[model samples]
Target chain A: MAVTARSRRVKPAGGFELAAWYFMRISGLFLVFLALGHLCIMHLIHNVESINYNFVSDRWTNPQTGYIWRLWDLTMVNLAILHGFNGLRQILEEWINRAKSRVVLRTGIWIFAGALLLLGNYAILMFVKDADYLKNRRDASSDAVTVRADVDRGASSRHPAAVPAFDVLK
Target chain B: MSVYRRGLVSRLVEGLRYGGGAGQWSWLLHRITGLGILLYLVVHIWDTFLVIFSPASYDAIMGFYGGKIHGVEYPLLRWAFRLGELGLFASVVFHAVNGLRVILFDLSPIRAVGAQKELFWAVVALFFFIMIPVTFIVIHALVAEPTPVAAAIVFPRNFVQAFVH
Candidate 1:
């Protein structure tokens, strides 16, 4: 009696499946730590509403901020996204039984996931330049001050209790 | 009073006990959680893209995530967020630990169901072992600790001089 894998469709642990199996386990572990740490800081520690552009910008490029946050975020996104796409590829193989369908679907998946990876890296790395964040922060601060002043000068009279404190924060 | 029950629950339990091996269950969980993370990835990418194009829209979405709809009852949303975080944590832990077991068994020659069962148990043990401390640290930081990044980022002399002066 030979040892058999549960999935008959998977061609008895062939090279591609074998490599993917190994990749899933290894990348899964990396994603666990990276993603958990990310969620810990982003969600558990800080309320979701607290994560405004300023907060993200600060984490990304502020000299006063450690580079670890940016690095951690980028690494987590890269690993998790790639790992996820790979896992989906495996699952789709099981679901799409037809060879032609599998090829078409896998090709589409590769293109989409690959494009997403590039776009994600671009948005994360390029948008976080300190100069840009600083400029936005300056503009935001001025806006905040103006809104604060408006409320102080009886802007509240216009809308009884509708002063948008949401707009004006440091 | 005994170790067994006698209804649909017992049938289900017995079925699970006899039905599939550890590999099956582990594979099932891995697929589920992988899909879970992928779903999050799609939304996360869209939201992040919003940051570069429209800060206002990004803020609006963040407000939704944060459950801040201008004076609505919040306990439900808060609990929902906490529960979702916990589920995500559990999924990550299980996927990681069990995934290691899978690789070990796959690489080695041990394919016996008994050994696989033991591997599954080991994975469960490790998951709980790591998660207990990780969960504590996460929740503790959330509640009592000044955000961890603060200390990491702040320059000590600059801070002391500026604040002290």
Candidate 2:
């Protein structure tokens, strides 16, 4: 921790890193409950074996439940990217203490975090609709059967798991 | 060193940094915890997505999780997984409460620098306050559940049963 002639003293440019630090403590607390609650619901209770496309469709199609999923998705995006970007901010704070570099780095973090948030939100919104397709267990089961048959044929022919040229999508 | 010594603000900032003041350590801890939590989130999401592909597959994947905590079947991995969850929980708790503190700092309706002192203790207080209960619940849930519980608690069992059946 000593400053030598070769090592210059680098000070954090502003209070943002401090803010991020405090933010971590706060977010960390909330995340414990959120994540635990999430785990209990998704993994610990009835087990994933019970979940299917119909399971998801039923959940999302419910007006109240859909809002809950939407909220969870938003919280995930907000906390995750912000937390990540803040970590990067600390790195920049440590190594890139100069004002000009700080500006550029902060800008980059913002843009990256913003993009991730947008993508996560889009996925959640699309999921509401996609849940419909997954609801049809019969169709999904047929697809699974077809895929399995293809795999069996490939196994007999000594073909790799890769799909045949004819099966390739455009 | 000379530059910092020449100005009050510079020296104060340097003191805060090297002195390991509340703000300084909070900043460092924030970075550490944030990265930790972010890593957890990635895996958590991937695991959850499996439920969408197929329930059977999802069960097959998760079947290995949450058994007797001290067996040769990747007991170390299991312990590590629990520890990682705890670590992420700690990180999340600290970050969120501290983030609110930061927000208040920005608002600065009152004395700004004075509030920084309280913010530090608040982080510590918040950590211990939340940790005790979370640790209790997590331990009880993990150990007591001789059988696997549901993947999600969002839907009660009765509701799920009614819907799925």
Candidate 3:
């Protein structure tokens, strides 16, 4: 590949894009095993039919587990997301030659990445919070079967995000 | 003209041979895997966000793909899913391992093709060193069961936690 004028004009030397290239490799290397393990367990061993809210819930809530799933997913989602957006940014730069178009595309990418980051974090953290709700309810309602039952019902609610919303929305 | 230094067909064959060296291979794998992950990430982001609207809505999507709604685990679909899983596994591994090598080679003083070639081989060596056992664990979990095998190996979360704290 010769340093064609078009290529030379576009190449930004030694900065964020360069750093992002480095980050993609580092993050990708980590994602290899993490993603592979996730795929094996979720897709291979159990099969898709077996995956449900309950399945996801158990991984987050089981006595055998801890905050492991929550944090692993958090790291996985964020890293995958950041790496992906950076990679796309490069493609966008190449494809969208016009400076104005590049800016618009970059802004769109940022907005998209931000929305994903927000929602992904919310879903993962909501599960974590739900786990905490179960833990506390178990600890506090040891003697109260009725209370345990109620908490269980509430925790398992269609949108247990309702503890706040159920109060406000209702 | 420079881009097609060789004819298209010859260039394709040369690419298949990895004629440029490890650097070229890294570049190739990164683009392929990056696109692969990007596609999946788009769907994932959409699905994860669906939860905000309603868990039922999220379940509706999962139900279609995985058959989690009626507990109808379709056997035939399993093979398709398995193929996808393996593809994703390969993409993630290649992209990641090659990515680390890219970072290291770029950061180092050596920008020569010779260094890039050598660094590429080193990265491949490191990738295999880690991936062989990981491959076993993945296979075992796929074949037998995952709970004991996958988590029992490196258990990366705990390992990383210990490293961090």
Question: Which candidate number maximizes TM-score?
Answer: 1
Candidates' DockQ values? 0.22, 0.10, 0.18
Better of 2 and 3 by lDDT: 3
lDDT of 3 by residue, B11-48 (tens): 56745764555555677777888889889888977776
List chain B TM-scores, each candidate.
0.65, 0.67, 0.68
Q: Taking the candidates one at a time, how many backbone clashes does each contain? A: 0, 42, 3
lDDT, residue A111, model 1: 93
Model 3 chain B — which ten-residue stretch has the worst lDDT? B145-154
- How does chain A of every candidate compare to the true chain A by TM-score? 0.69, 0.60, 0.67
- Put down candidate 3 lDDT per residue, A15-66, tens digits, no spaces: 8765775576677777766766666556433443335444456566555453
TM-score winner, 1 or 2: 1
What CAPRI grade goes to candidate 3?
Answer: incorrect
Evaluated on chain B only, candidate 1 has a TM-score of 0.65
Candidate 2 chain A least-lDDT 10 residues? A161-170
List, residue by residue over B1-165, the lDDT tens digit for candidate 1.
235554667745754675466666887787787688688787888898777777667655665554444323265674566557667777876777766676566566446344877778888888898677656644543344213223223334432432343
Q: How far off is each candidate at the interface, as Cα RMSD in Å?
A: 9.8, 13.2, 10.6
Better of 1 and 3 by lDDT: 1
The alpha-carbon deviation from the true structure for residue B31 of candidate 2, after best TM-score superposition, in angstroms, is 1.5
